[model samples]
Target: MKTFNVPIIYRSPLISAIKQQRKQQDKMKKDFTPTRLEFGPLTILLARHFGFCYGVENAIEIAFRTVEENEGKRIFLLSEMIHNPQVNSDLLSRGVRFLMDTSGKQLIPWESLQPEDIVIIPAFGTTLEIEARLESLGIAPLKYNTTCPFVERVWNKAEQIGGKDYTVIVHGKPKHEETRATFSHSRSHTPTIVVKDMEQTHRLAAYIREEAPAEGFYEEFKGQYSEGFDVTKHLGRVGVVNQTTMLASETQAIADYVRQAIQEHYQLPDDRIAERFADTRDTLCYATNDNQTAVTGMLNVEADLAIVVGGYNSSNTSHLVELCEEKLPTYFISSEEKLISPKELLHYDFHNHEELRSSGYLPQKENITLLLTSGASCPDAIVEAVIRKLAGFFGLEHLVDETAAAWA
Candidate 1:
């Protein structure tokens, strides 16, 4: 794996040392166990895989390097460089403005951009229409494009199957930038439709099974299908791809469901199932899978609560919180600043899209055990700060430095 020249502010001496040691011990990355950190009373089980992934590091490196190399010139991002608040704020502080919000709403007019100005495509990429719009403005969209290779892999897979007349079934949040970009790319090659989850997939399968009227498909799947999509014509052959950040297991389940539907509809045998369903294997990135698996592994051990650190809007982070919530109480926070005191803390409820404060988050006990982890875009520095804050509450703050020094 290639590394990026990320800013030092995002780095953590303790985290780097721990990760290096873990990597040395498990070169194959077969272990999903958490790293145990003991501080007399409070013990933290840190997820084996968490924080800045390859795509995020690469995007940050490009954004920062572009700012340094092109001083005095305006640099505009298509949207946020990544989902992390700290990273986006850092870029904003460096005078890198955004032309649109994450939902594709225009913040700045396209006419304001000059031919000499630079526009950066974020890791989530952009829609084909936006790319053409930028081209018309004389700005090269791909020149500073930080689109992750794994995401492009999904697009390539879609195109490959689309060439063979397979209708692409995208598993993702429809309003997501990556999904919009992927839908645009796949629809250009063949018929494409976006399904958010198994519930929506069930609804889509009704049409595939011909149990529902094709005319009702338009009203049921409004804005989810590509232009000129005919459910009757396209549902015969299909393939599944995902947003790369969604739950990998969920994506696989949806694919399995769709394949089974196609099999039942066509009365195809196991060997002949491929005749109806294109075998588009899991499209999730390595980081999302590893992190989610690590959480599952961590849950095997008993714990009081789980603390997930990352931007609230981050899709990967919410899925991490979702996994933890199934097993135990989970708090999603962006930084240590959310720890208002030892007695109370502020946390984001992603389901409700609101922040709420709660008392007695920490269990009243002699010895405490908790789980801690972050998202792909979260900086290790934020995780370290969160650990230090918890340590201070237990009056074992010095032990954190000692542990880091020992790891160092």
Candidate 2:
């Protein structure tokens, strides 16, 4: 809980009430619900945990400081500092350039970099090969490194598990920067493979059961498995870890599936199964856990429609949308601009992976309740903007002023 001086913008009375309720909840070790305020036509339900996470705050602080301290020097980011577009655009406007894109495509030629140029390693971290390349070009990766400590902890766990002579099964999107970094680091220690989801895990289990030909393994997991990975040999002893932001329940299910597959295949009892598969707990970050738990709490209350605010590419934000869509109508929008009107709204449907327009999203009920939450990289100021937009839709902008005045 290292505190940093990050500004939080919100309606003062609402923020104060939320803080008080959080304190009470902490004391009681139970969920706390603040009394709903009369803010015109909409009743906003703020989540207990949302917005910028520790990693995001640390990255922002370090990036802004780099800009302030090294005046006139060209500062290049290894990639987008975080997933949020506004944050990345702001850094770009400040003369920061990106060396690579999210897909690991080189935006700037590595040879162009000089010893004097400052290159900031992103929070997702860079592969060892990339690090070595930077070092060769006289760019010290450690000085401007913003890799999250939690992610590094996962890599360390992978190394420790690998040291025990077990193969590593990483439960995450293979193409994600964090996953790529972890896989590269883990492969150096032991054999590693990435499973995208339960579907892939089921296929892996079938492969472990020897129902599929061993030759298919190479073709099926061509780029995902480490070099010289033999399915028959590697699946014997394995340990499971995950990207820090994966859906918690899904990761647990994948681990359970792998453990059961190994047990049945080897005809080992519960005690003996531990020798083959390490029952590692989930590696999901704290912000993800808290925000997901809070979403569960929000689901206890009935709401007409849910507004999930954050970058569409953000894994945590998409999870929030997933949680909400299971029970209620959910709109995943990046900012207030998506709040086009009470009748129409534009949003990204993560399931379809496309932008869509929905009309008449607001319920006709006299008292409208909204479950509001944002991704870890989202700024609180954007959440405030969303609230103001909703207020304007209801012709209740005065309520925000009143709430601020009450706190003053």
| Candidate with best TM-score | 1
Backbone clashes in each candidate structure, one number apiece? 0, 0
Please report the candidate that would top lDDT against the real structure. 1
Q: Which pairs clash inside model 2?
A: none
- lDDT score of model 2? 0.85
* Per-prediction TM-score to the true structure, in the order listed: 0.99, 0.95
For residues 1-408, could you state the per-residue lDDT of candidate 1 as single tens digits?
898899999999889989999999999989989999998889999999999999999999998999999999999999998999999999999999999999999999999999999999999988889899999999887999999888999999999999999999999999999999999999999999999999999999999999999999999999999999998899999999999999988999999999999999999999998888999888999999999998999999999999999998899999999999998988999999999987899999999999999999998899889999999999999999999999998888888889999987
Error of 2 at 321 (Å): 0.8
RMSD of 1: 0.7
CA lDDT of each prediction against the hidden true structure = 0.94, 0.85
Residue ranges of candidate 1 with Cα displaced over 4 Å: none
What is the lDDT, from 0 to 100, of the residue 261 in candidate 1? 96
Error of 1 at 12 (Å): 0.3
- Estimate the lDDT of model 1: 0.94
lDDT of 2 by residue, 345-404 (tens): 999999888989999899887889888888888887787778888988999977876765
- TM-score of model number 1: 0.99
